[model samples]
Target: MAFYLVELTKSVTVHPRYFHAKLGDHVIGRLLALTEGTTSGRYGYLIAVVQVERPLPPGRILPGTGHAVFPLRYKALVYRPFLGEVLDGVIASLTRHGVFVAVGPLSVFVSARNVPSDMEFDETEQCFTSVVQGSEDRLEVGTLVRLRIVGMRRDATEIAAVGTLRADYLGVLG
Candidate 1:
């Protein structure tokens, strides 16, 4: 699956200066800013802060600096790419080694080997081109392509995937 809905809890710390009447609002604001758009190995990428659970508990305040650490619980929409998934994306960049496709917030790399056998990388032309059925096809930057996710790797802040366009239904799209 490309996207997943998950629940997450995070500790939102409020500084002493902003620890006023509407401290809850401040913490909630911090929560959204910190959690949304972040990626974790376990959670993939946080697409949105779906909703924050209401009636936050009175959090514990650190003694040393008077900073309050509020345990915030909420539901979020996250994007997680899975193996064997077919996704359509725009070609973000083209290189001699591979093509980088921007599939939503994820960057998928389609290496030279994963591309179709008939397509060849032409250094002078700066694209992957092929002649098929009396027509010329070109794969270049900004082209839309459909690829299958063959492998994936997760990092602390992003998810990377290897894609292939060698299948019958995969490759450049209109």
Candidate 2:
């Protein structure tokens, strides 16, 4: 899988289909910057250095535009998809379900099942709280955590993820 940092050249109106697209979603063409038009229509222009995910589409010649670049179906390429991978993430939002860890551009679901049982629910705080859950101090909302990926699935529509604080290195951080 290749990684490309693309700039929005022309303001392309993203269809509803594009909004919910996952992190690994793909795009094609030599992504370009908008010299004139806005990315507000069904289609616009861009200069992208895309890693062709499929055989190059049939090329055509457009007026003014040098080449009629074929629209290539971009395939989402996940660079890292596995357990034990260390990710820099933050506590996005929490619920009875689990804590949502925002790992860079992706969100990781750290389930309650993965949290050490030693951590107890604080009725006052409404969040799972623990004084010493096998870490330096505690586990609570807004606490910086150093977690190890314990489970993950990339094929699913939403990433199935779970983390752990059961190891020497995996736990709450100061």
Candidate 3:
């Protein structure tokens, strides 16, 4: 439920020639150039710039640098994951403490404690395995898994999540 498409106002600095009647178009171009593919600390990934509001007022030039600063408003689509949200991702790597999964722009870790108690790490194979009756269920690198987000931390450059595979309908998908 963390996906959102909403309007946001941001400042863009451009050359004075872009300050005319078609200012909105130039602002939109510059805004997309700056924000697309960038991760906002709070908003998560800035996926797409959908629309730009019409003609913002021309901004004034700075004393030393004659750059014009304009406030541009626009709508965008962003993706973020919340606690308890179940997501599917491929196992990227494994360590003694946990395994890391890549879900789009986010990287999630499923700690050893969060894995099912029945499963144990296999050092030789570098995978997790569980003996269920007479059968063995295994999880290895490149395996598809369904996990629930237990915790999250965000910084200027990245987002990290702590996940659990111990719940019902959670763990290796196939």
**In order, what is each prediction's RMSD in angstroms?**
1.3, 11.2, 2.5
TM-score of 1: 0.94
Per-residue alpha-carbon lDDT of candidate 3 for residues 1-174, written as tens digits (9 for 90 to 100): 378997888889988766577766777688899988888778888889887776566676877877888887889999978888999999999986889998887889999999888888988988888867775677788988999999998888677889999999999887
By TM-score, the better pick of 1 and 2 is 1
lDDT of 1 by residue, 13-131 (tens): 88999878988889989998998878898888898998889999788989999988988889999888888999999999998788999998889999999989888899998999984
TM per model?
A: 0.94, 0.52, 0.85
Where in model 1 is the C-alpha error above 4 Å?
A: none
Write down the lDDT that model 1 would get.
0.89
| Model 2 deviation from native, Cα RMSD in Å | 11.2
**Candidate 2 C-alpha lDDT tens digits along 1-174:** 123233322222222333333312322322222222222111222223344344534434456645343444432222333567766566776777678776654567777777667676566766777666464454555767767787765542344567765666665665
Order of candidates by lDDT, top first? Answer: 1, 3, 2
Top-lDDT structure, candidate number = 1
Poorest lDDT segment (10 consecutive residues) of candidate 3 = 54-63
